[model samples]
Target: MPAAYQPPVAAMRFLLEHVLDFDAQMAMLPGLEDVTSELAEEVLAQAGRMCTERLAPLNLPGDAAGTRLVDGEVVTAPGFAQAYADYVDSGWPSLAGDPAYGGQGLSRAVQIMLDEMVSAVNVSFGLFPGLTRGAAEALAAHGSEELKSLYLEKLTTGEWCGAMALTEAGAGTDLGLLRTRADPREDGSYSIIGTKIFISSGDQDFGNNIVHLVLARLPDAPAGVKGISLFLVPKFLPSGNGTPGERNAMSVGALEHKMGIHAQPTCVMNYDGATGWLVGEPGRGLNAMFTMMNAERLFVGIQGLGLADAATQAASSYARERLQGRAADGHGPVPIIAHADVRKMLLAGRAFIEPARALAAWTAIRMDVADRHPDPQARAAAHADVALLTPVIKAAFTDLGFETTVLAQQVFGGHGYIREAGIEQYVRDARITQIYEGTNGVQAMDLVARKVTMEGGEPLRRYLALIEADIEHAADHPLVPQLRDALALLADASSVIAAAEGDPDRLGAAATEYLHLFALVSLGWMWLRILAAAPALGDTRTPRGHAALARYFAAYLLPRAGLHAARIAAGPGPVMELDEELL
Candidate 1:
């Protein structure tokens, strides 16, 4: 085995078996009757094997030799293309897609497990499958019957890959500023003319055809996002038999070298009246895109968790193996893990990793409910909960993920910065989680401005009540009150944000701290749920590490909630008071 990295079976099982309660979910979804914990364990074991065996071994080499571009095609690392082929042959992409479209009909929990595993082993490699899953979700949710029937199966089965074309040079987060245009043609199709940047897998040799879901404004359309419409613009046009035929009018004008995820090609696609068809209604493009965004954003949150998990493992292994200075109490030539400070760092890293992973996985479970719930009321409730949590999930988990990787790098002392070792890759890979899937800043805005502000705080009230209910259940624990206090502080922080809405500067002033406050409370809620599900000290294979890690969060992580709450409540005065010329 290559340096024996221990999977966080404890955290993984705690998430798979509790909090989201997989047993109960499987019981309800009869389609998954054959898919028991045994099967899941088997699958995860297989995932673990594939990740470590195929993916983990590539991290260092892929980083050393990165994905190269030649001519107009992007090349994956040697063996990566074949490994990706094996990934598809395993039907891993279909784990949670609708069975109607060649998926295995599993729930999102399974997808979460697969997500965490792939992310840990190789984040760049994971990007391909991750983006595809999100696009499949978008098509399933809003594509035309013809569109869905034609492309969904191929996408799910990995015959083709999916790409979301939303960002343009003029628009990153502000979709209203997008300059892409779509005009209807006589053949029940549209022609798109615009350029999209930051497109992942935009041009790759991994698949035969890449489906581009482009968002654009129609001719004579109104200004802003109101005129927006979604279009299915494939890289290649499909012939009569559903096989990709002629090259579309689109072309990859250029590819930008990003800070990380270099293995996943980031292209600037030039669409010059590309043959495309409108998806959903004319003026509802953003609405349809949100279907992809919601799921994709949560997955990005899990991406952060996965990177953090990788970081934690890399750090912990280094700790146990790398001999360092003597312990504070003269333990003598101790493993770095023996040092109190090192232990503190390792524990703190685990604290965030465990709960962050749990929250992300739970969010995916709620999404599965939104996908497969038997009752309408339950489905609607699940939808509301997902909407309420998605922003926080993406923002908080990814924020912590970045922090965890930093700590992991720090723990490596000098080895992390050196490219010969792969610890730096975790830091590099973790960086983009906060930048994409709606910047964490945008996520915070969505949480406070939209999700929380719904109907003057009905969503906020419902969320607060739910947190209080969790408090009630976990009251027996001493840590529960501290968490409750954090929730209350979050409420106050939200109130301050609401109070500042009229102040133009307040929005920008509170943006960062607003995200911080949001992360605190959302993580607090998640940690409480995780602690409540602490596993009994039963077996070697069982995951009972929650208690130790929960204690770590209580002492080290939870107190930061107070700081975030204070910063958010401090208002925009201090920030806004600074004269414009002071700099």
Candidate 2:
């Protein structure tokens, strides 16, 4: 078997304390004054213990056993129910929820740390609570007071779980194509009739109830996306006292058989005139749903970050122990770690994993600031930052995450291919991250077409300025100049795409490469920050380790930014030249 997951507690602490200065940042945000570095460390440490002891062992078994549909109910794999119960009893789900809604009200940065741990050990299990948190965020932002009072606490406390019912058989990314319909009732409720496919944790026996935030159109609603409206449809209608009461007119049509995350029940849901309530203003469903979708996009990015770390840990452990070819001294067979090629694969994974973790955490901190900062200007700036980086994180993190897993698998040679080695599971699980939460291709387009040009490109300019300021701080560092050059390339590419506003094909053709270029530069900037903070880390080995990885990233990974920039400059004609039916 592959080496068991070991949470990067020290590394996490180092980022929070030294590199990101998370505690200081939290102090500036309203209501997060008490979120100290020590508290964050303790929380991460305890979460790591829970994941290592309670959740990690369930991963392989859960995947092997998977989920099954029996008599219209989805039954989870063995031990999952009890594990979820334990998870709730320990109050794990309330980490970042609103205090008024029975949540601990911790900073999102801290919650994201816990999320990374959960995802690393048991991604299948993480989906159960992950979707709940996303639902709670949407409802908190747009749900009626009565709806929040009636359901928010239970959802926040994990007494109930939530699922997003958005995709239909014919609609995946295009919400405008959905045929689901909702009709208003005299009692202010609506009758929802639709089929939603690819709903994760759509139904489960573990939670007392499941609150589905569905997207549907009204009877007189306009055509396309403008007609869409958000609704809250519960599996069990709430009673006078708020407990689950009568069953709603909904059932699992079927559970999907997938390549990985087998323990997560991806369901096709049928809402046969299900009783529902409108979440936001009429004809504004997509707006409310995007609130949840945006949160999920960030959460999905962390999922990739978690898997990358897990796969890297497993491969590094194997490389240190597994004897293979002889060392340069021509002695007996030595550990694979001694081989140059094996070291390359391992270092490449590390180069991506460390910076990716930093970037995810950095984004989470900005999210908290965007939501909680007392200053309007600060909040707006943070919001702009979050909007600009969300798609990049979602796309690049998952793309590299899948690549890191495959690289780790390569390190195992033939052994990695087998089930017994366990590395193959990470590869299979990582594959889906790139495809879901809007495919990486779609995310790339969003980054280039919308976010880059949004506010007349002020957000992109602000982001580049931030990087340039930081580069100035470490001007003497060897990697700073490389990061500076990459930033310029990204800026030039952004301007190129922005200049082609009239041509849709230009944006489409340059989207993926531009996003890749952006991610590389962003990660390069992260490595520079790490190098600057290495001295305060207080240990020779730790600082030296970070310096080496920073060097490796500059030498091996950052150069790709140049290639992506070149591709972006190549324009769209070559891509658009081919006819649809041509051979």
Candidate 3:
């Protein structure tokens, strides 16, 4: 039995083979010569098994049982430590970490598929490793060479764990409001003293030593975000023999009991004169932190993808098993899945997840290029693509993830709300994706403000051109005639936003709508492209399923794209004009 989970592998296959052109990615990445379609399927199949058999089984209890906080230590859910150990032993952790640092150094698409699998299986578990990916990315990008050698290897191998400490009670969204201080010591170290709240993996027993990447302001520094600096604040001092010695002055002040992802500790950390080393130069900490934060944002968005996958799978399973009212044309009391409305809901869920998965994977593939392209210009182009797509991947995947998870819950109807049923966990787990790692609203603002206008939409223009090229390449193929049309819809959405002028409010209100529109049309593009590549998905000959998925999105979901077009056209007037006390 497949259990209550959707097979993201099939979707992943569609993406890798058809949508992303996986073989091309393998040709690009060194040591990925073995990543043929057959190998890819086996990898995805194993991922599905591990996630479904190992992780999903623990999620419900993990939520109900949660993590134990005793004496300022967070003990993750049952089987978590062991499962993670097994997962590490399996080499999954190294999928995304740099090759120089004991990682597999495979394409980002591989990592995204792995992430989606784990997230779909158990979100809390997803956090523990997901944080590592962010931490490793930061270290690789900004940390000193010494820092990279010391931390990246251990963190990469899962011998050590990592957490980012950026948020304070006063500075949740606005880093400018933070009051943490870092005074440079006579040596190369600094003395960090501050309070950080909602720090994930701040204090955990999962690894030997937890590395806290803290953000603080230096003495004589200017005010606000510009004044801040980043520090390597370890939980305990690293001794000469790969062991932990003196306890660093960082502790968990409190732990939160949240609505979801309970086993993933949400902590208030106190850094009291902790010995710290600067990762990058002072007054540039925000810039350095964003290196990690951007990666985290994308991972968090994938968290959304994972939960939605779980929800849809769970709902789909329940729908096929649960006897419900017959379809108007069918025999009595067939499975709910036999009904037209249930099919609609399942299709709706797919409408969100399939394309989002493709996009996330595509973004990851680009990451490989950014990180490893032999040429500087090619690397820069990859970096630019990663930057431009990061917000869209984060925001669009998550927003759709929430909707799909809810629909999954609805598929189960009354049972989903009950804890024993376990469907609610997906709902609860997915909610956090929208809240943390830069709120979806923040993501929208970044998309509209920083990503779009700042570049004069050149980045977006480049992405559109790439899509255009993909359509042109696939034009003569039987499965690709519809791709150009999808590209046109996506192009229109991008152009409308790119075309918008001086009216910030006009741009702002429409920002969310535009992102949604872009996501759908983009997914439509992904679907068509992936469909063309379906031959690699064990059999591209069956165009029926892929075509139906495309049609479902095109007919039903694309209208939302149009709706967003309307909202974007309306500008911000209706949204901003409302007075504060209307409620």
Candidate 4:
């Protein structure tokens, strides 16, 4: 059996109500008057129960059985289709979609909480709806009304599924080099011919139809990324009545045998003269698809947070039950939880997971603000905040996610290496988060190159100002001093990177480390916000636990801020000094 996943209901509720102040934020977003703390709690509690009871049981089995390509069609692991049916029947996918598209129109923060619960229990299962929602959002934003009329409702309601087909064999991160072709036909659709690899939820056994958001080049278009265009292609072409009709000319060539997430199909997809309709304008596919990528990036970050927490829970539970060597007091053999080393591992996970969660929730609230805030200036500022922090969340959450799971597995001794205890499964499942949704390395480069350097670091400075404002909000809290110092270090580091205008090498070398530094500082700020909010939450275990975790994070984790800041100031010389041919 997989470990029992206890949804962090209280933690999520505390943050939604107290720290992030979701109630107040919701009130500001028009048409969101229906969202309340009570609704959020209910959604989380129900979603959590479903995840633990329904989804968690399938995790190991999914991993063991994996997905297969049989007779030119992909078949999902056993139990996945039923669980997904239940998931759809629960109306969960509609939580964050637009109200106009047969959805509940809930705030993005609530969806983030739900995502954490789903990911913690079964990440593979979660990808189906996750990609569907991503595709729906992209289509709703950029696709023509006729396309949305035909597809968005089905996608938003979980009647159909979606996939992002961006990478060709020749193009991984460099979309400009992609050779996928889209030749226009007189009927207004295009013939898409390309192969997209490593596609998550590319083809599966569950949903009725799969809608793919594809990137291809128009025959007469300009070269490079500027020539790319986004298209909506379906497994079975929709008839005039918007129902499945004749089969599209796309097929799953093969399934990827991967190191992790075996239940989720990582596919090699081929589109041979597939019919597709263009989205947005020609030569602007990147701009259109970014709508999906940005959303998926943050969602991937939360996946890391979920897996980290799940692993920690499994390891800590095992530690409490498995008797080991005698305690330091020389008594009989005690549960390993009595050992300080075990406690250290547990604390490390807590330190990172709690604040990382807060950061995700904070960012989710900003996503709502960016889209729905009444003031135009506030919306733009919120948009900037989202852009600046997305990569930090993506890279740091995943990198630390891998580390936390390893630490959790280490606490399990040899048992973690095997699958029986279920801890090892988390390790394997989490390994992919670092690699997909754009590798953490690419996220780091984007942080430095686009977010910081391109705009002369105005966004970074603005984010620092917001942190300082929060510091002022929590001025009386214990972590305030540490928060102030981190704020300063982040500000200084931003200046250093901004100053390196002509030095791409320096920017590239320091980018990853700088992102780590930024993430730590961001977490510290979150802890301070939690501390500030704890007192208002009344006498409860949630507040008490929040205080303890904040102290632990400040004492053990915030000190790394100075180290990263120092390295940022040192520039790229240490990294770039060596020649490529050096022994």
For each candidate in turn, the TM-score is 0.95, 0.98, 0.93, 0.97
Instruction: Supply the TM-score for candidate 4.
Output: 0.97
lDDT of each: 0.79, 0.91, 0.79, 0.88
491-526: candidate 3 lDDT, tens digit per residue: 665666666656577667877887776676677667
Clashes of each: 1, 0, 7, 0
lDDT of 1 at 528: 81
Candidate 3 backbone collisions, by pair? 6-313, 18-530, 18-533, 19-530, 506-572, 534-540, 535-540
Q: For residues 1-583, what per-residue lDDT tens digits would candidate 4 score against the true structure? A: 4357789988888888888888988998998877977789888899899998999888988889999999998999999998888888889999888888889899898999999889999999999999999999999999999999999999999889999999888899999999999999999999999999989999988748999999999998899999999999999999888888999999999999998899999999999999999999999999999999988998898899999999998888888998989987899689999998899889889999988888998898899999998999999888988998899998899899989999999999998888878888888889989988899989988888789854566667777887888788675655778878887888778777777766789888788878999999889888877777756767463635777777777777888888888888887888888897993
Candidate RMSDs in order = 2.1, 1.2, 2.7, 1.5
Best candidate, lDDT: 2
* Better model by TM-score: candidate 2 vs candidate 3: 2
Question: Which runs of model 1 end up more than 4 angstroms from their true locations?
Answer: 1-4, 29-35, 499-504
Ranking the candidates on lDDT from highest down gives: 2, 4, 1, 3
Candidate 3 whole-model C-alpha lDDT, 0 to 1: 0.79
Better of 3 and 4 by TM-score: 4
Estimate the TM-score for candidate 3: 0.93
Report the Cα lDDT for residue 305, model 3: 85
lDDT of 4: 0.88
Clash pairs for candidate 1: 10-543
